[model samples]
Target: MLEFALLVTALMFGGTTLYSFGFAAFVFTALPAETAGPLIRRAFPYFYLFVLATSAVAAILLIARDPISSASMGVIAVTTVFARQVLMPAINAATDSGDKSRFKRLHTLSVVITLAHIGCAAFVIIRLAGQS
Candidate 1:
């Protein structure tokens, strides 16, 4: 079970890291903003869903062995729900309405939320896998 929890936590960490640093970066550099923006917007829902589901599963798996990690995953899951349901739509609306300030504010919030989730996942993985 610990091994399985570690795997799931690693999956959560790896997927977010790859998407944030790898896929998103590649998309923006490879395509024009006009092309990349919409493509990423289309993909965000799926990404949020992936985070939410994976973190929720990790939370359950870690609940017995590591309550702290489990709670961290739980927070990641709940926060992701807010990101998907509320923050995402507001950001879209801000973009559509040409509200640069609003978009900046909301987008920054989203970035912070994503980074926090990644940090939490990383911490959990390190704690579960090994001290080193």
Candidate 2:
């Protein structure tokens, strides 16, 4: 179970890092703006869903052995839910309405949430690795 948790945490960390740094960048760089923007927008919900599922499972797995790590994973799961359900729609509304300021603020919040999730996943992995 511990090993399962560790593996999931590592995969979550890698997925976020790669999507943020590699895959998203590659998409934007390789594709035209009209194509890339909508493509990324379409992908964001799935990305959030992935984060939510993995984090929730990791949280459940760690709850028995490490409360601290489990709590962090729980936070990631909850925040991803918020990002997917609330923030993403708000962001789209802002964009659709031509509310540039609102869009920027919401987008920044989304980015910060994603970064925090990534950091927490990395922390959980490091903590688990040190234990064994």
Candidate 3:
């Protein structure tokens, strides 16, 4: 049961990570700036909520099952999710509404942080995968 729970948590985090990457790719590549604003506005809130809920559940499951092995991953997962899903979008939204320079700076920072989060998630997933 513990293994199963861990696997489920991993899958949730992995799936959310993939989904976020796909969305980020779309924002970076296909979408025009005009469309990007509207698209992000429409999509980000729901995505944020989804990530938050999933990460929360994953963390709870991890803590309930095995604290030592899973807790680190859970912490990383939660942090990544919060940054990608909550903080970035909020910053982006603020930038969109405010000064161009500020927007660019915030966007750049968000992108770098988000990429780092993805890397962290990937590392956690790989490590946990081997363990389980």
lDDT of 3 by residue, 1-132 (tens): 456555555665666666667765678678787877678767766665565555455556667555654565556556657666667766766766786776777767656754554565466556556766
Ranking by lDDT: 1, 2, 3
- Evaluate residue 128 in candidate 1 and report its C-alpha lDDT on the 0 to 100 scale: 87
Candidate 1 — which residues are off by over 4 angstroms? none
* Rank order (by TM-score, best first): 1, 2, 3
Residue-wise lDDT of candidate 2 within 25-91, one digit each (tens)? 9999999988997898899998988888899999999998999999999999999999999999999
lDDT of 3 at 23: 69
In candidate 2, how many Å is residue 6 off? 0.4
Residue-pair clash count for candidate 1: 0
The 10 consecutive residues of candidate 3 with the worst lDDT sum are: 113-122
User: What range of 10 consecutive residues in model 2 has the weakest lDDT sum?
Assistant: 33-42
lDDT of each residue in 25-124, candidate 1, tens digit only:
9999999999999999999999999999999999998898889999999999999999999999999999999999999999999999999999999999
Candidate 1 TM-score to native: 0.96
* Per-candidate local distance difference test: 0.94, 0.92, 0.62
